[model samples]
Target: MKNKHLFLFILLFVGLVFILSTTYTVLAEKDRRYYENTGEVVWEIDTKEKVVALTFDDGPHPKHTGEILDLLAKYNAKATFFVVGENIEKAPDILLRQYNEGHDIANHTYTHPIKTTIPKLEAELKKTNDLIYSITGHYPELFRPVEGQYTDEMIESVVKQGYKVVMWSWHLDTEDWKDPGVHRIVKTVLKGTEPGNVILFHDGGSNRSQTVKALEKILPELQKQGYKFVTITELLYMNNENEK
Candidate 1:
């Protein structure tokens, strides 16, 4: 009787473990699939072309933004700048220069708010859109949520405002926001980048000297690899073409 009871307890424990493991795996897989789908928020493009989109956020910084622009010019590379509305207000000419330089200017919200109501989020996006339009005479068709933090309601709001939500490839995040050393930033980006990647960087936040240094190394290396830098719109267009 004792042996039978022990055997039954062990069997039940094993069964419970299997059930829990299976449930965890299924949930994880579902989350992965949800993020990978390109119908709405695009993470990366599907293509054979050696092209990548270099995107800067929280920008129009008084100094860093210009430095980044100069670097892009040096390489004759184009990029997409997701500018904050308040920053644009401070430096309208910089935003205008970004437009004049032929780089894509997109909306990153009027203010960088992490948590807010759907109505507030919508207003933020609209304000930014109007601001950019006021300067460039064109409203941005692309919107990247502040900090890539978005709830379904936030996404729906942006979509209703007639913008495509953009996200970067997970592996391509340089973590430059942390102000990690320049070498690390360069290594992280160059090592993780592949064809059709959307590489993320920042141009507006606290001292971006390290980011600038990393770019010095990153651009030449990537160009040497034959990877052409294009704006996010071009990358998306390439993706759409490949799908067809």
Candidate 2:
């Protein structure tokens, strides 16, 4: 009886170990794919060159959108803007300017709601996607969840509906909402930029003058540093072609 009890205990110990191992593997994978839930593209890019994709979120605001475009034009750089749907609808002309000036406009959802399991996420996404298509004549393949908030279902739904999840590799939290000074914004980006890095800047909601000012300095500085700014699609396309 003693021997049998010892064998049973050993079997239980082995079973516990196996369960723990499997659990770890599952958690790691879930973490790996968590960014996908944000309704953005999380694919890898080629790092062969000193190239980066500069992306902006939450705008097309009349106040700052035009200024942001002017700077990009001055530098002859293209960027991707994840725009809120309601904002786009209110300012179709700004959307036109973005398209006309040679930038890709992406969806950031209609209401820009926080990404919890809200009943409105699906509708919000659809509304924004539709609004963008209505004005630009094309739907952006990429998206960024409002405030970078998301759940697993949010990622799955966007993918199922045909969109790539986009996130930044370098974020100094411009806190553009708080209007951090232009010097701090420019310094943060210059100090943090790296090859194949995606930098986040903003161009909407409240005063984004600091963001506008920061770019005036950083765009030219980054050019001198030998970085080429490309829209997300162009960057991805270049990398894909190289791989082939």
Which ten residues in a row are the worst by lDDT in model 1?
A: 23-32
TM-score, candidate 1, is 0.85
Alpha-carbon lDDT of model 1: 0.85
> What is the TM-score (0 to 1) of candidate 2?
0.81
- Show model 1 residue runs off by greater than 4 Å: 1-38
Which candidate wins on TM-score? 1
Q: Which of the numbered candidates is closest to the native, going by highest lDDT?
A: 1
| Candidate 2 residue 85 C-alpha distance from true site, Å | 1.2
Model 2 off-target regions past 4 Å? 1-29, 33-40, 43-46, 116-119, 171-173
Provide the TM-score for each candidate, comma-separated.
0.85, 0.81
lDDT of 1 by residue, 1-244 (tens): 9999999999999999986643422332334346447356677887888998999999889899999999999999999999999999989999999999999999888888876787887789888888998889998999887767666666566777778878788777788989889989999898999999999999996788888999999999999999999998898888778878
